[model samples]
Target: MSTRRYILDTNVLLQDPLAIYAFDENEVVIPAVVLEEVDSKKRNMDEIGRNARYVARLIDELREEGKLHLGVKLTNGGTFRVELNHRSFGKMKEHFLERTNDNRILAVALNMRIEEEEKQSGITVTLVSKDALLRVKADALGIHVEDFLSDRVVQYDRMYTGYKELSSESKQIDELFENKKLLIKDSPISNSYPNQFFILKDEVNPSRSALGMTSKDGNYLESFVSSEEPIWGIRARNVQQRMAFELLTRDDIPLVTLAGKAGTGKTLLSLAAGLYQTEDLQKYKKLLVARPVVPVGKDIGYLPGEKEEKLRPWMQPIFDNLEYLFNTKKPGELEQILAGMGSIQVEALTYIRGRSIPEQFIIIDEAQNLTKHEVKTILTRVGEGSKIVLMGDPKQIDHPYLDEYTNGLTYVTERLKHLSETGHVKLQKGERSGLAQMAADLL
Candidate 1:
């Protein structure tokens, strides 16, 4: 097969520093303008900055092997080079006169296509980028463009819901209810993941149903174990919420992920379970609630105040749930209540790095805004005797580089579904209210 050239954009590298090695036996071209873009972001103190520095270091190491401008051999049997000669705007200036870094990168890809066609080298050139507008422009200019797909865990439509429905015999459903555990071999499901929930219906009468979950060993489908009792004055309003409660309250499961649309009760249920475990059952020492501070629309810039005051705007949604759980209606009353209760801690995910948290009920709200690497960093901080719950609406992601399928919450749910110590639930019904549910569904 003829070799193909893949020109990468700066966002591709910043999104994943190891993207250069993803193309096997194909030439990877990094436009010199892209390097300049990376350099501009290297001083940032966030994840983007870290990725920029890492990419720079990787390219620097490659420079020692051979001249980067000339090209260097990659470990994956691919060639890497910094394309400097394609700096001219050329025909691209006729359309995009902005002379932006994005246009510069596009120029390189456009020039390479022209060069290959002129030489009749039979080499296909493609532009790999995460920017939608850039991809459109590249296509208009008659260049092939593709999204960075290496980090995507699953398609959004086919994403794991953590629950499935199965048809079983009436006798088997009765047996499952009677014995409390039915062998998987006798069920309709040919295979089952650990902690996966099931809605078993009688094949003869579909309405005759029972809720069950796969045994940690994947051998038996056991009945749901959570009681009907209200947790922190909150009861599971639906089957999926019940499944989420079962996963959240289980001490053996250290990792629980809940994904849903807005008003699906993901956050309220997680918060209730965390409070019950930490405050009522005395299972955990603290209830640590946190979320990524990703703004929905345009940012309002920085706020002036101490840490707690600064976090109030970003954390108000969490506080609304807390006030409801605590039954505190007065303004500023929740703050005083929280201050007295040392075991309950609400903070931002920013400070969670490099800290070992043990014996805590941790709830990471708005987790869909996090990247896979950010999720790994947060999970690695969990010490012994800690349960971390990740809950978010994948469809409502606010992160610039993340989408429904590529967000951290979706990545964790898909990757860790088979682990015995992990549980996941995708809440479909919105329990917040009629208007909220309608908005979530129709809007």
Candidate 2:
């Protein structure tokens, strides 16, 4: 195939500035507007802003090797150049080029398509973006548009719910649960994870069975261990969320994994259960909450204030959930409550290495942004009396190299789901506002 030229939208650059490297040695184009957009966001300190700055530095490094407009060779041996040419289309009205940034990005994609159409060398110029509306507009213009499916849900539905049900003979169910490792011969559950949970029932009677899961080797299935205590005032509204809560609170289950889409309440429910168990029940001495420092909406560092003030932006989501759970109508009540407990702690996972934490309830949110090594480092820090809950919507990840299946969250789910002491749940319901749920479903 001739060289494929990929034009990155501003969102793409902001999300994973190094994303240009994913196209192999193909020619990559950064639209001039995308640079302007990224430059504007580079001053911020959140993940997106950090990514923009990183990409800017990367481009600078490349410029030192060659001309920026003439195309510079990347570390991967691929060539990339910035595109500044802009032409109004006959089919598009001037309104399309107004003050909005999304439209300009779309226009650039259309222009690239026009120039590529003249080549006829099988040289494809595709618009890479995360905005659904932009993709729709590009499609209407006969220009190739894609939603940077870089988040990588190969079979979006393949996202599993760490739990399954297997109907077996009543005698088989008893034997499997009673034994340490009841190896089965080609059982259908052979494709499951180590700590995953399963409900084994009689073939004739749906209710006559036991809850179990397969081993890491995909052989035996066993029961699940719920978090230290059943979280009162916290229960799953849906079957998946229920399963998620059950896994999140398990004490025997040292590593609990959760996957879901936005508004599924994965993060909220996990925090609620962690708080209930750690603060109320004293299942663990302290509750340690940490995330991968991946920013979702805008950057945080650019906003003024100290670390605590800077953290409010990142900690806002956590505070939102805390506010809801505590039924606090006033502002700052959640922080005060968490502070009063002295048992609840919120921190970033950046400096957790070499620090052994025992007797703690560790909740890692936005785990999708974590690398395999990073997750392993955090998981290994768990000491006795400590249970760790890792939750994130793999589809909405912020990391660059990590994808849906290959991410650390999925890696742990794949590696530990078979253990009887570990479990996983994928939240599918979005209990948030109707618009949020609709956007999650449609987009």
Candidate 3:
């Protein structure tokens, strides 16, 4: 097959410099502006900055072999080049957002398209970018564009859950649980990949069923959450939410992380159970909600404000939920409830450092924004009598380094979902609204 030319955008390099390996050794092109862009971000403190430094080192190592401007042979056997199509900006339109970097990257791809047309052969100068808006603009210019497909979900509604159910005799079920594995028919109960864990409920009593794990190839993946706790919220909106309620309200399940797309109700359901426990059941001394203050693409530094003012952007969703929960109360009534109980705390992840929390129902929103080290720090800070709930949509991460599968939230879910003390449920339905769910689906 003829090689496909992929013009890597700055975001792709900032996301994963090694993304060049995924295209079947196709010819990869990095615009010169993208290199300069990576250089400027090399010193950033976040994941993007780390990726910047990584890409630069990668290019430097390749230069040791041959000229970068001409072409360098990638370890994947693909030829790569740093395109330097420097043309006078005086000929192009400038706008108030002239400082916008995306346009410059798109310009390089556009120039490549022109060069290809001059060669008397049809060359597809496809602009590969993660920025949705950039892809939209490229379409306006009649250029082929695509987003990197590696991190995409299998289906908009699908997620990796480690549980499968079987309809065996009670004796067979007993044998499976005793062995801690099962080979049931490939239903929801048996339809899991390696490392996926599940609790095979009675489907009748749900509480009476045994716990079994599916194998790596669904070869009887083994693990269970027999963590004993009082049942609550049995009538949750979805089966997944009901399962999540069972997980979050348990004390033996010391750590629970829920991950999925936005509007999947990860934050809402966790907070609901936390509130029900801390305020109504009086199981914990406090209910805490906190999240990393990272923005999806940028931080709030450009917007002038004090801590509360600056934090308004990150904490707005938290407040919106609180608003809905306390819908009947007057404005600020929820804040008063928080103060009266001293029970509910909506905090920043930074302030949580070095603190040991006990007897608390803690919800860490946006856990995906946290690095593995940061997540470890938060998790290790848990004292006795604390049930920590970490919730975030890994697919919607703001941190530059991690993706859907690699973020700390997903990392923890993958590693800990098999134990008896931890329970995980990925809510696939977006119950927020029709538009919200549709947007979460298509966009």
- In terms of TM-score, the best-performing candidate is 1
Question: Using lDDT as the measure, what is the rank order of every candidate, best first?
Answer: 1, 2, 3
Against the reference, the lDDT scores of all candidates come to: 0.88, 0.73, 0.71
What's the ranking of the predictions by TM-score, best on top?
1, 2, 3
lDDT of 1 at 326: 95
C-alpha lDDT of residue 427 in model 2: 74
CA lDDT of 202 in candidate 3? 60
Name the regions of candidate 2 deviating beyond 4 angstroms. Answer: 1-3, 74-77, 86-100, 177-181, 224-253, 259-283, 289-341, 345-359, 364-386, 392-422, 427-443
Query: Residue 397 in candidate 1 has what lDDT?
Result: 76
lDDT by residue (tens digit), candidate 1, 1-443: 43699999999999899999999989999998899999998987777888899999999999998999988899989899999897778778789999888898988999899999999999999999999999999999999899999989896488888889888889889989999988887545538788898898899998889999889877888996674668999998999989999999888899999988888898888889988888889999999998777652223346887888888888899999999999997898998998898899988887676799999999999889888888988999998999999999888878877788888899898998889999998899999999999987888
Candidate 1 residue runs with Cα over 4 Å from true position: 186-190, 225-227, 295-302
Decoy 1 TM-score against native: 0.96
> Across residues 1-443, which tens digit of lDDT does each residue of candidate 2 receive?
32688888877766566688888888888877788888897886545566778988988887898778888877777888887775444445643646467777767777667766776677787888876677887788788877666544344556567777677887777776677345654867777665666767799887786766565567676554453234656656665675677666656677788788888888778888887777677888988887655543233446688767777667678878778778898777777887777887877666455699999888888888876656777888999888888888777767644567656787777666546667788777798878999999997
